[model samples]
Target: MALQIFETDPDARPAPKVKSEYTRPAFTFRSGMQRNRKPVKLDNWRIVAEELEPLKALAELLGGTAEEYSASAREPFHVLTETDSVEIVIDGAGAVEERMILWGPNGPIHECDGVEFLSPADAKGKPCGCPKELDQRKAWAQQGRGPKPNIPIRFRLAGLGYELGFGLLRISAWTFLPDLDPLKAALAAIDGEALCTLELEHISFINDKGEKIEYSKPKITVQGAYADAIAEER
Candidate 1:
């Protein structure tokens, strides 16, 4: 065999298209603060981003406050907005999925459809063995043997316009599962094009042991068709 050498000009090749660095933001209903070497929780919807303009816009629209914080060395800083509720536009019924997920420290360890395992390759299609009754499922979850709801609803901030990008609200609490069926039905009826409100409803009560209990639950309210919403704005 004979060896051959070839010369090429790097600049002769066309430049590749610049890839976008855009990522869909998240709408979180709770945040944790470090206190006494532990995390204290706060109930409020939070919008976080690497940039400030978008967070400011969201804070202004949702009647919240935007603030900057030191996240870490790699990303140095981040902007966040905390609010009680925000309006959004759901594109269609396909924007949401109701599933259950058991996550490990790194990622999902198992996923299910309430009755059967759906992931981890080998576990797919196997019986999940979750209790058919809701209460029993809750008990199972409490014992760390069952998955929790992991419904993710994708939507765009109602008045912010899509140029800023979409937002995702992932509902993981098992208590919120019951309330989702009606919302899912409504989204389906409207073909998923609807103006919706995402809010955290505070709940407080005393248990049988006389201990005060307080928490917040995420709620979704469909305002109307997306077209009508835009028309009214116009």
Candidate 2:
């Protein structure tokens, strides 16, 4: 056989890369805020994005004002809209796993599943040495010695003709842990086709010291299929 040299086509173009819908969320849904080293839980969801147009559109559809904020030089400008509840359709399975994430000034320093490390490549799979008791684990997390829960749920806004792309909601509150399994089961039962309402529930109670505490917890309620929901509304 004779050796031959092949020439590449000058105009040949590579196929474009396709990004996962979940990975390209248009906005983020936040349930809490921080001020002066204290956490502030909001009774409504705060929808934030780097772009203003989508947030303006969202405000129009959701009956809230979209306002822009000047962030630090290292941070991008933010546009946010607040609403008590929003209808969302989780088309398919998104990131719903419960993991512990500990962040430093740069980024995540450690990630684990309580029993084993899942990040920092060199330490992956090693025993994380987290406290077995929930209270102790919470204490460790509070003291910045352990990781905190990070459960992310991504979905498309149900209304607005489903044209606003996706919104990511990360649930980091330890109090919400008890509801994860049921929510996952509900999402799986419908094959991720259910119309769900993401809202904040105001929780108030008295502690052992007779001190009254009030806060809000994010809640997800499955409202069945989108079409069925619309038909019922009609």
In TM-score terms, which candidate is top? 2
Q: Candidate 2's residue-wise lDDT over 1-234, tens digit each?
A: 753333355355455789854546678887766667698777667777777778878777766677655464222333344578877887644446678998999999879998999988899999988889999999989999989999888787876666777778888889999998888878777743778888888889999999999988788888777667777888
* Local accuracy of candidate 1 as per-residue lDDT tens digits, 122-188: 8889998888999888787778887888888788887777777777777777778778888878888
Worst 10 residues of 2 by lDDT: 72-81
- Stretches of candidate 1 above 4 Å error? 1-23, 26-43, 50-53, 63-82
Error of 1 at 74 (Å): 9.9
Clashes per model (N, Cα, C within 3 A): 0, 0
Q: Check candidate 1 and list the clashing pairs.
A: none
Q: What is the alpha-carbon lDDT for the whole of candidate 2?
A: 0.77
